[model samples]
Target: MAQVLPPLLDYEQSYPCPVCRQGQLDRLILMDAFSCNVCHHIFSVNLSQQSICLADRTPALGWRWARQRWRPLHHPDIDFPLGIWILCGGLTVLPPTILWVMHYIFPPLPDSSANSFPLLWIGVVGITHSLIALWILAEFYQLPLYLSWKFRLQS
Candidate 1:
């Protein structure tokens, strides 16, 4: 999938932010520490166990880094009404495919050349519908939805 934006937080490297307590402590330009986008406070990283606030660091330990893996995290936006993603994907794929199949399987009769106009119209409509669905999917992808390696951290 094409990623349009970098995430606010890198899950493999961050945890629930201690400073803001809303967003995660996202990794900063430096690898050893993180900064919360919410509070704008930078904190140190404790790679051994959990999110720990060192004496000198800002945000300290709460959720620990226990497990991590990379997968497509569903977008919170379109997920509403649920199964919408599947529906969009289906619409993107199914129409053109069906039209192609029907064209091959049900060719126009030998003397029905003038009647093929409707088939052309259907093909154009299918292509337009497919492009619309694809555009919708692209918008979802561009909406900051990302695949992350999330850790099952404990509080």
Candidate 2:
């Protein structure tokens, strides 16, 4: 069976917000633009191209209206490649594993608290690296936390 592509949305209709994914994009009164109730983002609609772009940002963020959902439009300059994902994963896992292995291979002296394996430090390092990795990935992936701070600063 052949798949049919969704028709472009008319200016009168409401669609899901591409940025927040939680709000409906309602058309603004006396204007051709749309705004999301949740994110409060203004979007410029292009009927000819069948797309909506974030009106306030440079290097415009945009999405095309599919029948059931919005499809994100990609910009090469903003997209991170596979290498960055790999690096993030490494940053999340490598340091903790190395510390664990070192602790196991060179056991701390018994009855000497000062020569302990420093398990708290190991956990701290793991959590810190994991948070850094999560933050980087979230920013690139456009997660809610990153978007909140990003848009907050602009406002």
Candidate 3:
């Protein structure tokens, strides 16, 4: 009868530091190694010879809570909606509002074009919509800064 060996575990699958397991790592200081906040231990293990190090061991509980609270607003993956909103609002709303004001200020010419009362109403609607969009955008802009500060404090 031949003796059988158990399967070898991959380094990536194994815990780099015995003190801190994978999920318990508050932050990954390097690709393979992490500092354990619970035990305040810094240890290294071989993970593809990257020479990774773990320096700090403070947990970021406040940062984590803040991130969760402002999750919806701090998405870097999405394009900044405010920039698009401002651009489109300016292009679509300003011209109509100007035209509407001009119509009210100046009397119709003798060889007159038709009255633009309909367009004037549309302009008012556009301006109202743009104002609402701007308010929402202002609220979103603060979120990124909040998250960045939180991360910085954590590290």
lDDT, candidate 3, at 124: 81
**Could you give the candidate ranking by lDDT, starting with the highest?**
2, 1, 3
RMSD of each: 13.8, 6.1, 16.0
What stretches of model 1 exceed 4 Å from their correct place?
Answer: 1-89, 142-155
Q: What are the runs in model 2 whose C-alpha is more than 4 Å off?
A: 1-6, 75-89, 101-114, 131-155
The true-versus-predicted C-alpha distance at residue 21 of model 3, in Å, is 33
How would you encode candidate 2's per-residue C-alpha lDDT over 98-131 as one tens digit per residue? 9988988987888777675568778999999999
Per-prediction backbone clash count: 6, 0, 0
Model 2 weakest lDDT span, ten residues long: 72-81
RMSD of 3: 16.0
Ranking by TM-score: 2, 1, 3
Model 3 residue runs over 4 Å out of place are: 1-114, 143-155
Clashing pairs in 1: 51-61, 52-61, 53-60, 53-61, 67-151, 69-149
Among residues 3 or more apart in sequence or in different chains, the pairs in candidate 3 whose N, CA or C atoms overlap within 3 Å are none
Residue-wise C-alpha lDDT for candidate 3, range 114-152, written one tens digit per residue: 556556566687777676665565444545554455446
Decide which is better by TM-score, 1 or 3: 1
Candidate 1: global Cα-lDDT?
Answer: 0.53
Using TM-score as the measure, the top candidate is: 2
Which is the better candidate, 2 or 3, if ranked by TM-score? 2
